[model samples]
Target: MNEVAQAAAAPGLAVKRNWLAFGTGVGIEIGAADLRVSVVRLRPSGARLLGEKTIEGFRHRPAAQWGAEYNAFLRTLGAAHLAATVLLPRRELTVRTLPMAGVAEKDLASAIGFQLDSLHPYAEEDAVPAWARLKG
Candidate 1:
């Protein structure tokens, strides 16, 4: 079985998992000086890197231009169907972790939502909050 879910937590991104034992994922990292894109195929056996691209000085270039270039790169590798996980530099983001040891998976969002305001400086109206539950 393959389940595809549109994550309300992150707009314009889709999460998919296959019980058939294989899937694909794309990651785009925005570094200090460049935009890097990579695609990988995940199977029960292992993860295989499909393709990658590094666009230098992406900040100086128009987003539409570079975005198209990146899109083309994915299309060339037949990975245009995958939703990319965009990674921003750590310093550029405010990262926080909470001890949700007893929080059930279903209530995770509400647990985070209850503490959202205290976690960041942005006002509720202006802030866009995203979180992930990591297994340590």
Candidate 2:
């Protein structure tokens, strides 16, 4: 059997599956002063850029207006039933890499929560944290 089939059969072995299968996908980015959208087509071989557009005046507009504009833009692309991912501006995110040694998977969340205030600018109550372990 192939590696994929073997991994799927073994319950103890965790298999990483491609969440974004071969198809068109929309990536939306909401920036402080602009909104950008990109349509990409993914195949087993590679990815192809289908379309991309950026609009200004995000800082001056309200959330509802931006939502409407985004809907209209998606309509223009006819992006129906396509996988989509929205990315927030980098400025709005606080990213950190914490070195965790000898920590179990189940206890990582609580461990990070304990150090949230020190790792990020916001207090523990105000911050949302997510982490992934790096493979060597």
Q: lDDT of all the models against the reference?
A: 0.83, 0.77
lDDT string for model 1 (101-136, tens) is 888999999999999889878766877888888978
Cα lDDT over the full model 2: 0.77
Off by over 4 Å in 1: 1-20, 95-136
Worst 10 residues of 1 by lDDT: 11-20
**lDDT, candidate 2, 1-109, per-residue tens:** 9997987888644323343347789998887778788988877566888788786797787878876777777777778557679898777788778888898989988
Q: Give the Å shift of residue 68 in candidate 2.
A: 2.1
Work out the TM-score per prediction.
0.56, 0.58
Give me the displacement of residue 76 in model 1, in angstroms: 0.5
Worst 10 residues of 2 by lDDT: 12-21
Measured by TM-score, how close is model 1 to the native structure? 0.56
Per-candidate count of clashing residue pairs (backbone under 3 Å):
0, 0
